[model samples]
Target: MKKFFTILGILILVLVFVGTAVFLFNKSKEKPVVYETSSPFITDIIQKTVATGKVIPRKEVNVTSQVSGVVDQLFVDAGDTVAKGDIIAKISLAPNMIALNNAESQLESAKISLSNAERELERQKNLKAQRLVSESEYNKFLLDFELKKERVKSAENNLLLIREGSTLQSDLVSNIIKATSDGMILQIPNKEGAFIVESSTFGSGTTVATLADMNDMIFEGMVDEAEVGKIREGMELLLDIGALDSEPFQAELEYISPKGQQDQGTIKFQIRAAVKLQDQVFLRANYSANADIVLDKREQVLAINEGNLIFEEGAHFVDVETAPQQFERRQVETGLSDGINIEIVSGLVESDKIKQL
Candidate 1:
């Protein structure tokens, strides 16, 4: 009976050891690596570079003050359409006290001189009619009197300009700000009671309002120096506006800066493109956008995943599948790449299966 029990225990220990070995062996074995493969297909490949910037009007006219004064009233606000010569805002003249006092004094002196001249001219006319004075002498007095009267008028107009920033004979009121061009008012930078300086030769002065033609819009952006050389005027651009939800806007390159500007330690070149507006879509000024400038493009060409291409010393190769679960290295001529799919110029057919890295 003892022998029989010992034999049974040994048999149990042997079965436990066999089970542990089988479990470890199965866990150590690796599954076969099935490399996903993609076949070359006909598609459009466009190589482009992205530039960040904003969409704004092609020409922005700043409605500036013509005379220094305090804003009394605003006839238009932001987003209002305006025409040339339309009143944008009214400014109350903040006339200089010294200048006003001088103008008043000058006007009073001119009146006194005109009163004296009128009396002298009356006496001269009477003398000439009675033949008591020569005709030439009367003519001289008349000319002097006329000159005095003109001086009085000139003084009066000067005083009026100083007091009200306008004159009786002038049509343009200096205190009234008007639109310089036909466009929509983009912004009103000043409020009622805000004092602004007039635009003069010495300074640009305060901008009362910003006006722009919304119909003519452009995309102004900066491109990296490395990519600027690949672009030129008349190229096409696809604009992606962050504020709009519709399709990307189309634009044509118009201007490229001759110089580069440094931003955040990287040199960037400025570029401008005229945006082609679509119906029912309105693009506001300064809408942040990203532009995809196409440098090269290929239409309906054989392309494959760019990751499948392997680079050696100076040649490009791809692992083309010859049979199921088999691949061989083959040299391929490449073309435009849109950063994902690359154009397969030669050495590959539409039915060729390429390994995905």
Candidate 2:
């Protein structure tokens, strides 16, 4: 019985060893990896980088109140087209009590002074007409009376301006906020009765509305800091607005911020590109967009898939096909690369076949 058990265990060991040997031998005999071969082809290569941003009007004007007041009435809303000097909003003046009191007091004092001057002028005229006073003396009284009258008028205007936002001289254009340029209303941040701060030499005021020429739009976005050096102003850009998914818009690079901002563990630089408007297609302001900025371009050049090129010690080389299924290392000068295909500057021709790595 022990001999029978031993024989069975030996047979099992022999079967396992034979199976392992057969598996190992078959794996070793498997075919090696074979990459495809292709020759250089004539094609256009465009090297570009993408910047994510939004579509904005090239010129956006913020309409702010000249006086601290409440937005009493809004003349227009978003999407309303306005001409230059068109009223956008009306601001109700929030007059200061102290300033108003001072202006009124100043006006009253001027009125009293004017009355006294007029009475003195009457007496001086009588004396001059009867030849009791010299002509020079009468002229002095007349000049003083005129000056006092002018001061009274100025004080009255000043008082009126403090009480209301406008005087008699500016009643038509008073606290009515007008558009500085012709454009469509993009936004109305303040509603009726919303309190607002005045824009003064002291501080920036609250914006009542935002206006922009929708025809003159732009793509404002940011790019990674690593790709900024390859771009410059006036480069053509392909802008893809997230809102308008029909076709990509064309833009021209215009602004690149000198400073870089850190975001999500990476540095990005701001960029602005003017969008080229198309007919019958309206591009709303602040619509999100992505810009494809071309860094370089090669037209009708001999190029190959970038994967086939190998970089060694800063020099690029490709495997040129010597014969079927055989290749030889050949140094090649490269030019514009759009990441997928690269321009082969030298060491390869359109007819010379190259093997892929």
Candidate 3:
């Protein structure tokens, strides 16, 4: 019985030892989490927002006809430079036989009326010299003769204009469409024989061509209402034209619309920026571009990757690896952040290491 009790006691000790060994093996099998660390360095931090828009000229104009007629000639084509008062196109007057005949008849009648008024005035003057006519009668005859002459001149001028597009006394023609400013012809829709309708107050008629001053290009974009307040006139911007696939260009904010547009339950305001071109880059009208507005820029700032930061209890902190398997929670003073990286004002140095959790 003593031997059996001793054996039982040894069995109990062996069981306890096996249990402890199993527990330690299971604990050792657990996966250990690894951490990444980086050192803070002085860098440039720029906070920016992207906006999509197009490259437009500072001034663009659509040249249209003033009268409806067949296009007789196209004086300029696309890419041609034109000056103010330069004729862009000419329109042929359509058949309006009735109107033309009436104008002609009216002119002839006015000439006859003027001749009769002159003869009557001469007779009145002679009668007045012999004291046969009153002074008021002679004055009335002289006034009537002068008024009739003016009417004859006006009628003849109108008739000449209706027949030949212009009169000897007039400088303008209804059929000739001229440029209002010095610019390049961006488009010419109507060919030499295409018919065009004139623009009227009631409606916008056919557009003959588009004229634009390509020398001055502007970047037009929109900013969300939430970000519009952060943007203002005179702010510098970086522009990227997707089509060019080249380097970004520089621009300055020039205009911001006071009103906002409601789209998809979000408000956006229109903005215009003047981009000075280098080497006269060919920027077609409405070319797609992205404007990057730099809201903040800082140089030589101590910054770290934003992934290393931890926000807790209204304080920004980071895990610092002081030694092997040792880490400490440290609070840091931060300034401007550039989304990907944050500016660290204090509580960290370039030589110190940061653990990303």
Candidate 4:
């Protein structure tokens, strides 16, 4: 009985040893999670928003045809500089057949009337020479002849104007299209054979070309309605043009639309900024660009990475490490943030280590 009890006691000891080893193995497998730490440093925080738009000239004029006709000649093309009153294109007048016929008929009728009056005047002159008619009656015949002569001349001139777009007594410029402003031609949509509409009281007409002063360029873009209110006129802007990567142009805000237009799902307000360009650098019209509007900025201020900040209620706070691997919740006063780093206004010193959340 004593031997059996000794064996039982040894087996119980073995089972107890196995349980202890299992517990030790599970305890060794557990791992602890750690976080990173950082400290505030002197940095620049530029808070800005980006607006996508295009670069365009400040003063642009569309050259349109004066008469409905086909394009006869184009003297200028895109990138050509022109002065005011310079001939940009010529139009071959497509005269209305019905109007031409009516004008011709009117001229013929006036000529017949003038011929009859001339005969009457000659007869009156003979009668007056014989004292067969009063001087007043002869004078009336002379006035009638003169009036009929003027009408014939007027109708002849009208017929010539309709057929040739110019009359012999006037300058030959009725079908000639001239530049109204001094600028560089940006576009010429009409070719030599393209039919163009005349800009009259009736229609806007076809745009022969678009001209503008490229020296005075502006960045035109739209901004979200939420961001438009924070911006005002005369604010500085930095433009990044996709075409010219090396040129960094600056601009001044000059216009902001009072109303908002719905685009996609958001309301946008159209804005324009005057681009200050260099003489050597040329900014072409309608180049896609992005405008970085600086809303606020801070130079060489105590700033921390925004990741270290924790928001509670409406205030901002951060987890500051007071001891080694030990952090405490501390309320911090923050300033401008460029989205990556936030300016630390108060609550922590340069030596305070901030833990990442």
Candidate 4's TM-score reads 0.83
The CA lDDT of each predicted structure is 0.92, 0.88, 0.88, 0.90
TM-score of 3: 0.81
Model 2 earns a TM-score of 0.76
Model 1: per-residue Cα lDDT over 1-357, one tens digit each? 999999999999999999999999999999999998989999998889999999999889987887888999999989999999999999998888998899999889989998998999999999999999999999898898898899889898999887788888888788888899999999998999999998899999999999999999999999999998899999999999988999999999999999999999999999999999999898999999999998888899999888889999999999988889899999999998888998988999998888999
lDDT of 2 by residue, 1-357 (tens): 999999999999999999999999998896976868888999999888999988877788998888888888998989899999989988888887898899889999999999999999999999998999999999999999999999998998888776677767665645789998999998898899999998889887999889988888778899999999999999999987776757888889999999999989999999998888888688887788879998887799989999999899999999888887788899999988888998988899888988877
TM-score of each: 0.91, 0.76, 0.81, 0.83
Best by TM-score: 1
Residue 217 displacement in candidate 1 (angstroms) = 1.5
Ranking 3 against 4 by lDDT, winner = 4
Q: Which of the two candidates, 1 or 3, achieves a greater lDDT against the reference?
A: 1
lDDT of 1: 0.92
Kindly indicate the candidate among 2 and 4 with the higher TM-score.
4
Query: Where is model 3 more than 4 Å wrong at Cα?
Result: 1-28, 31-33, 95-98, 114-150, 200-204
